[model samples]
Target chain A: GQQVQQSPASLVLQEGENAELQCNFSSTATQLQWFYQSPGGSLVSLLSNPSGTKHTGRLTSTTVTKERRSSLHISSSQTTDSGTYLCAPFNVGDNSKLIWGLGTSLVVNP
Target chain B: EAAVTQSPRNKVTVTGGNVTLSCRQTNSHNYMYWYRQDTGHGLRLIHYSYGAGNLQIGDVPDGYKATRTTQEDFFLLLELASPSQTSLYFCASSGTGVEQYFGPGTRLTVL
Candidate 1:
C-alpha cells in the first residue's frame, strides 16, 4: 500500500514565526492536495499543488514528483493558522484513490 | 463556494443497531467520498462514488455499505454498528482531480 507520511506529528510556533510541514509518499501521485482541519472541525482545502510549486497568499506548497514528496510552507504564521495540516496523494499505482497522511498538528501561539 | 452538506451532525447509536448517514452536494460534482476520522487514523476512506448509482469500495470498506441513488445524494449505512465505528465521518465532493470540498462532518458514537 502506498502511504503518505507527515513529519513532526505536532508543532508549536510563536505568532509571526514560520512553519514548515513535510509530506512524503510511497508512490507516484497524479494529484496531491493540502488540507487544513481546525480543532474539532471539518477539513478545508488549503492548496492543491499536484506538481511543481504553488503559492496562495502566505501559504506555499511545493511538490516534487520525482522525489514523491511535498512540503507546505507557511510564512509569518498567525493564530488562526493553528490547525492540522493534511497531505493526500491520489492515483497510487493502479488504484486511483486518495491516500492521506495523519497530519501535522500546528499551534501558532501569540 | 462549493457546498457539501451532511445531515445529523451528531449521532449516538447502540452496539448492533443500524445507522445511516446522509450527504448532499449542490455543486454537481461527479465524485463523492465518505471517510472516517479518529485519533489514530486521521482519515480513512470508507467508500466513494463517481456518479449516481455507482459505488466503489475504499480502503476501509469493511462493516460499511454506501448507496448513491442520486447525483446530489450519497449515504453511508451501518447494518450492525459496533463500538469501533465511533468516529467523526466526513463527506466530500470534487470534480476531476481538483481539491475536494468537505462537509462539516458527522460525529457518530456507537455505545
Candidate 2:
C-alpha cells in the first residue's frame, strides 16, 4: 500500500507570518496536488506541481519527484487561511488514484 | 471551472439501512472517485471509475459499492450501513491531469 506522510500535523502562526507544510510519500508519484479544506469540509484544489516550483497568489508548491517529497508554502498567512491543508500525490502506475495525506491543520491567529 | 456536485449534503440512517450518495460532474471528465474522510484517517478512497460503466476498486471498498451510469453521474451505495461507516464523504472528478476537483461533501451518520 502506498502512503503519504505529512509533517507538522498541526501549525499555529500569526496572521502575518508564513507557514510551511511538508509531504513525503512512500512510493514514487507522477504528480502532486495541494488542497485547502475549509472548516466546513469543502475542499478546493490549490496547485498541482509534478517536479518544480509552482506559485498561485500567496501559495507556493514545490515537488521533488526524485526525492519523493513535496512542500507547500504559504506566505503572509491570514485568518481566512485557517483550515486544513492536504497533499495528494498521484500514484506512479495509476494516474486515476491519489494517495492522500492526513493533512496539516493550520490556525492563523490575529 | 470544474464543478463536482453531490446530493443530500447530509444523511442519517439506521444500521442495516440502505443509503445511496449521488455525484454529478459537469467538467465532462473521464475519471470520478468516492472517498471518505475521518478525523485521523484523512481521505480514504472507496471507489473510482475511469468512465461510464467502468468500476475500479479503491483502497477501502469493502462496505461500499459504486456505479457510474453516465459520464456526468456516479453513485455510491451502502447496502448495509453501519455506525463505523459514518463519515464525511467527498466526490471528486479529474481529467487526464492530476488535479482533482472535489464536491462540497456529504456528511453521513449511521446509528
Candidate 3:
C-alpha cells in the first residue's frame, strides 16, 4: 500500500506571514493534487501539480515526481487562510484512486 | 464548474441498521468515488465507479457496498452497520483528469 505523509501536523502563523507545507509519498505517483478545507466546511481544489511548479494567486505548489514529494506554499497568509490542507497522490493506471495525507492544519492569527 | 452533491448532510443510525448515502454529480463525469474521513487516518477510499452500472472495490471495502445506476448518481450502502462505521463520508467526481471535485460531505454516526 502507498502512504502519504504530511509534515508539521499543525502550524500557527501570524497574518501576512508565509507558510510552507510538505508532503512525501512512499511510492511512485502519477498525479498529485492539493486541496483546501475551510472552517466553513467547503473543500476547494487548489492545484493539480503532479510535477514541476505551479502558482495560483498567493499559493504555490511544487511537485517532484521522481522524488515522490510535493509542497504547497502560502504567501502573505491571511486569517481566511486558516484551515486544513490535504495532499493526495493518485496512481495513473488505478482509475485515479487517491492516497491522501492526514492533512496539515494551518491557523493564521490577526 | 464541476459540482458533486450529497444528500442528508448528517445522519444518525443504530447498530445493525441499514443506511444509504446518495451522491449526484451535475458535471457529467465518468468517474465517481466514495471516501471516509476519520480523525488520524485521513481519507480512505471505499469504492468507485467509472460509469453507470459499474462498481469497483477500493482500498477499504469491507462493510461497504456501492452502486452507480446513472451517469449522475452513485450510492453507498451500509448493511448491518456498526459503531465503527461512524465517520464523515465524501463523494467526489472527476473526468479523465485526476483532479477531483468533492461534495459538501456527509457525517454519519452509528449508535
Candidate 4:
C-alpha cells in the first residue's frame, strides 16, 4: 500500500518565525490536500493544490506531482498556529485511494 | 462548502459491547469514509462507500462493519468492542474524491 511520509515529525518555533512542513507520498497523484487539526479538534482542509503553488491566508502549499511530494509553508507563525498538519495525495478519478501522513506536530511559543 | 455531521461526538463501551456511530452528509457527495485517529497511526480508513447501499473495505476494517442506508446517511458498527477499538473517529465526504470535508469527530472509549 502507498504511504505518506512527513518530515520533522515534531517542531517548536517562535511566534514570529516561519515553519515549513514536508509531505512525500509513495504514489502518483493528480491532486493533493493539506489539512490542519487543532488540539482535540476536527480536521480542517487548508488547501487543495493540483500541481503548483496555492495560497490561503499565511499558508502556502506547493505540490509537485512528478516528484510525489508537496510542502506547506506557514509564514509569520502564531501561537494559534500550534497544531498538526497533514497531507494527502490522491488520484483524481479515485480520491478514495489517497494516502494520509502522520502529520507534522507544530508548537509555537508565545 | 461541504457539511458532514456525526452524532454523539463521544461514546464509551465495555469490552464485548456493541456500539454504533452515525454520519450524515448533506452535500450529496457520492464518496463517504470512516476513519479512526490514533496518536501515531494518524488516520486509518476503516471503511468507505461510494453511494447509498455501497460498501468498501478500507485498509483497517478488521473489527468494523459499516452501512450506507441512504445517500445522506452512513453508519459504523462495532459488534464486540475492545479496548483497542478506543480512538477518535472521523467521518468525511467528497464530492468526487476531491476536497474531502470532515465532521467534528467522535471519541469512542472501549473500557
Candidate 5:
C-alpha cells in the first residue's frame, strides 16, 4: 500500500506572506497532484505535476518523481487562500489506487 | 462546465440501517471513485470503477458495496451501517489523467 504524508499538519500565515507545504509519498507514480479544500468544504484539484516545477497564478507545484516528493508554494497569500491543501500520488496505469495525504491546513490572517 | 454531483448531501441513519449514496459525473469521465474522509484517517478509498459495469475494491471496502451502472452514475451502498461509518463521503471523477474533480460531498451520520 502507498502512504502519503504531508508536513506541517497546520499552519497560520499573515496575508501577503509566502507559504510552503510539503508532501512525501511512499511509492512511485505517474503524477503527483494537489487538491484544495476550502473553508466551506468544497474540494478542487489545484495542480498535477509529474516532474519539475509548474506554476499557475500565485501557486507553484514542484515534483521530484524519483524522490517521491512534491511541494506546493503559495506566494502573496490572501485571506481567501486559507484552506486545506492535500496531495495524492496517482498511477494512471493502475485503476483504483490513488493514495492521499492527510493534508496541510493553512490559515491566512488579515 | 464539467462537474460531479452527489445526492443527499447529508444523511442520518441508525445502526443496521440500509443506506445508499449516489454520484453522477457530467464530466463524462471513465473513472469514478468513492472515498470517506475522517478526522485522522484523511481520505480512504472505498471503491472505484473504470467504466460502466466495472467495479474494483479499494483500501477500505468493508461493509460497503459499490456499483457503476452507467458511465455517468456510480453508487455506494451500505447494507448494514454502523456508527463508525459516520463520516464525510466524497465522489470523484477523472478521465485517463491523474487529475480528478470531486463532488460537493455527503455527510453521513449513523447513530
Candidate 6:
C-alpha cells in the first residue's frame, strides 16, 4: 500500500508570515491534490498538481512526480487560513483511491 | 453548483446496533467513495463504487458494507457497530479526473 507523510504535523505563524508544508509519498503518484479542512471538518480542494507548480491566490502547490514529493506554500497568511491542510496522492494504478497524509495543522495568529 | 451531500450530519448509536450513512452527489460523477477520518490516522478509504450497482472494497472495509443503488446515491452500512467505529465519515465523488469533491461529513458515535 502507498503511504503519504506530511511534515510539521502542526505549525503556528503570525498573520503576515509565510508558511510551507511538505508532503512525501512512498510510491509513484499519478495525481496529487491539496485540500483544506475547515474547523468544522468540511473539506475544500485547493489545488491538483501532479507534476508541476500551480498557484491559486496566495496558495501555491508544487509536485515532483519522480521524486514522490509535493509542497504547499501559503504567502501572507491570514487568520481565516487557519485549519488543517491535507495532501493526497493517487497511486499510479488506483483510479478511485487516494493515499492521504496525516495533515498539517496551521494556526495563523492575529 | 456540483456538490456532494450527506444525510444525518450526526448520528449516535449503541453497540451492536445497525447504522446507515447516506450520500448523494449531484455532480453526476461515476466514482463515489466512503472514507473515515480519525485523530492521527487521517482519512482511510472504506469503500468505493464506479457506478450504480457496483462496489469495490477499500483499504479498511472490515465490519462495513457499501451499496451504490444509483449513480447519484451511495450508502455505507454498519451492522453491529462498535465504539471503534466512532469517527467522522466523509463521502466524496469524482469524475474522470483526480479531483474529488467531499461532503460535509457525518460524525458518528457508538456508545
Which structure among the candidates has the greatest DockQ? 2
Count of backbone collisions within predicted model 6: 0
lDDT of candidates 1 onward, in order:
0.92, 0.92, 0.92, 0.90, 0.92, 0.93
Each candidate's DockQ: 0.74, 0.81, 0.74, 0.77, 0.75, 0.81
Q: iRMS of every model, one decimal?
A: 1.5, 1.2, 1.4, 1.1, 1.5, 1.3
Q: What is candidate 5's lDDT per residue for A1-110, written digit by digit as tens?
A: 67899999999999999999999988888888899999888999998898999999999999998999999999999999999999988875555467889999999999
Q: Which residue pairs clash in candidate 4?
A: none
Best by TM-score: 6
Task: Score residue B102 of candidate 5 by CA lDDT.
Answer: 92
> How do the candidates score on chain B by TM-score?
0.98, 0.98, 0.98, 0.98, 0.98, 0.98
**Native interface contacts retained, candidate 5:** 0.78
DockQ of 4: 0.77
lDDT of 1 by residue, B1-111 (tens): 899999899999999999999999999999999999989788998999999999999889999999999999999999999999999999999886457899999999999
Between candidates 3 and 5, the one scoring higher on DockQ is 5
Tell me, by lDDT, which candidate is best: 6
Higher-lDDT candidate of 4 and 5: 5
* RMSD vs true structure, all candidates: 1.1, 1.1, 1.1, 1.4, 1.1, 1.0
Report clash pairs, candidate 1: none
Quote model 1's TM-score: 0.97
> TM-score of the B chain in model 5?
0.98
Question: How do the residues A1-110 of candidate 4 rate in per-residue lDDT, one tens digit apiece?
Answer: 57789988999999999999999988788778898999877799888986989998999988888898899999999999999998988875553566789999999999
Model 4 misplaced regions, further than 4 Å:
A92-95
Question: In model 3, which regions exceed 4 Å deviation?
Answer: none
Cα shift from native, residue B36, model 2 (Å): 0.4
